[model samples]
Target: MYKPRINNKFHKHQIMMEDPCLAEFIPETRLFTNNNLIDLLNKYKKVIVKPSRGSLGKGIVVITELGTEEYELLQLNKQKHINGLENVYKYLKKLENFNIPNIVQYYIPLAKVYDRPMDLRYIAQRTEQDWTITGKYARVAKVGYALTNFEHGSSILTVEDALKSSTIKNFNIKELNEKLNMVTLSITTCLSRYFPNHKIWGCDLCVDEKGSIWIIEVNSSPQIKGFLELESLLPMYQSIVGYKTLNKKKGRRSR
Candidate 1:
């Protein structure tokens, strides 16, 4: 029986790891061993441990400062923890023993919309000679969830709505768009230098209290599900690939 091979989800991360600047966009990650976990908690006093290749917001935990002595631990899709360090470590160790490949990321206090965390997902594509913004959507974390992934029952809204909401005070929609576009272009341009042929990309970014944008993650194969008028997107993708093929043929003939 022939079996289908699994695609490595970390392939994109490996590529990003090759470039120092790109790697900085990735979260601070480490294997979940006892020593590593202890060190993480001690250094940051608050950290998040998640699956390395996880998606959809499963198996995530948020650690926050309660006081000098106490800590709060909240599990993704679960109740909050207001307990001591001993209990928290026990709970996390149990999760670690479950054979899940986990990493601890420095928790970024994201800007909020409606008392909920908000993040930007920018869809980007490369044309024959230029990289362009295809679309951008804001992912808002559902009540009581740590991450703003759709699988965790989060809601999706346009970037426009997020900026206009009262929760996002001091928000400027036009300026946000400009900043997001600039970051997307910068990331795509840097990646293109290494993989000149790769064209499509999706970037996850977060804005902190000071309105500075920080890249959270990068996705190579972006899901176009729920995008409006995807029929319009098909032609753009066709033209990009079509032009590349035509150029390759012309080069061969000239040679």
Candidate 2:
């Protein structure tokens, strides 16, 4: 049997983990299991367990420790407060209906806006010979949501607007953008080396209350309809078309 390369969350995470420097930006992630859930919840007090191959924030659950032997599970946009570690596992299993491949990551207290969570999405695409960042925007999660997925009622905001309203103290927009770009590019470069055929990436990142940046996820197939609505993104669309044209030309020459 021949298997195709799938860009699942765990696979991409492993690829990034190969590099020590890049690994630092990644949160502590592991295969979601009964034991893993108990340990991570106790460690992080607030951990996120999401589908390994799911998108649009579907099937994502947020688990928070209320106290010893007590926890709160957030899923399906609702909160269920439960007691005991074993009960947490049973509740999740019931909600899932069976075992599903998922990843459990230590939740970082991301910078917020007006008490709403938010994250930055870096749109990087490959040109003729190199990777370039074409767009950057912030997704302010809907009130009381754990994920900032655009499909889930999240609003798109300019990076400046997000930073201006950010809860991170002494936030520097200029410095943050610089660091974000550098890390986004680095991730694309590393992933490209492994999956050379893929050229576009949408990297989701966040800044903690302490001003430390963390990579939440790297989306290989990012939705662009929301971005296309902005007239300012015209140049980026052109660049993408240009890259397609250039690649076509090279393909002809090779033949």
Predicted candidate 2 versus true structure: per-residue lDDT over 1-255, tens digit per residue: 223245588888888888776899999999889888878887789999888886778788888898888888887468999989898888777765235678889998988987888898888887755888877878888887877888988877777788888898886779987888899999988888778867678899998877889999888878765566467666766666566577667668978
lDDT of each: 0.67, 0.81
Cα RMSD (Å) per model? 6.3, 2.8
**Candidate 1: which pairs clash?**
none
Provide TM-scores for the models. Answer: 0.72, 0.90
What would the TM-score be for candidate 2 when compared with the true structure? 0.90
Poorly placed runs, candidate 1 (over 4 Å): 1-31, 80-87, 96-100, 166-172, 193-197, 226-255
Best by lDDT: 2
Q: Give lDDT tens digits, candidate 1, residues 115-160.
A: 8888878777765558877677777889977688766666777777
Model 2 CA deviation exceeding 4 Å by range: 1-4, 97-99, 229-255
lDDT value for model 2: 0.81
Error of 1 at 239 (Å): 11
